[model samples]
Target: MDSYRNSDARPPIMQGSPPAMVPPRLDWDRPPWNRWAFQHIREILPTAEVWRGTGHRHRLE
Candidate 1:
């Protein structure tokens, strides 16, 4: 059995180092940098759930 086949396996990204040698301000939609940015999206772009009402249920269209 291959080690990579294990369910716990997490493949190394950018050979297990930070994505760049001298990190530029990331474009975030490009390759390489996009990989790291996407992994940490929750930290970069925070979100909140909006409560519509307490006693009313909204119908889905």
Candidate 2:
């Protein structure tokens, strides 16, 4: 498995300004890329904020 982290040569996916790799929009959710895609879903897909009335207060650990 390729580390979600960058390899010796290149930066991690989507790290650079124009993005290092944009795996086809159709397969952005596929194996190798899904790792990063899932973490940045709001940026990758069109998402609207839901009114949950003040989301989780605890900062990410």
Candidate 3:
């Protein structure tokens, strides 16, 4: 990583400090199996779109 830094682009005064690392958003460190379970459940029971209310019962002749 040190080779990537250029003196012309970056000043030599900031060499003492290390680069900052960003943490994962959703606990990526966990095992893949745990993540797969959550993804599958969402697909099985997806939200439904309700168009109309319950219709009234009709009388037979």
Candidate 4:
């Protein structure tokens, strides 16, 4: 069971390399905050459902 124990205690690594990039620190009034908010608007906002807006139909004749 040594292998199993080691696997559980090992730190997570990305292919033994450092993280691809570190996200910038967040400040409540900084652009990073606004940028993050805009990108995640769907999660924070109570959006209406998007109904079927396309008219494409199957033509299997």
Candidate 4: lDDT over CA atoms? 0.57
Model 3: per-residue lDDT, tens digit, 1-61? 3565554575667565674333344543356644654555444345666666688867788
Which stretch of 10 consecutive residues in model 3 shows the poorest summed lDDT?
20-29
lDDT per residue as tens, model 2, 1-61: 7785656676466665675656678888998989988888887889998776766777668
TM-score (all chains, Cα) for each model: 0.31, 0.47, 0.18, 0.29
Highest lDDT: give the candidate number: 2
Model 2 residue pairs with clashes: none
Q: What tens digits encode model 4's per-residue C-alpha lDDT throughout 1-61? A: 4677776755676775764432343543356566655666565556777776689877788
Give the winner by TM-score: 2
TM-score of candidate 4 to 2 decimals: 0.29
Ranking by TM-score: 2, 1, 4, 3
Error of 3 at 57 (Å): 67
Lowest summed lDDT across 10 adjacent residues in model 4 is found at 20-29
List CA RMSD, all candidates: 11.1, 13.7, 13.7, 11.9
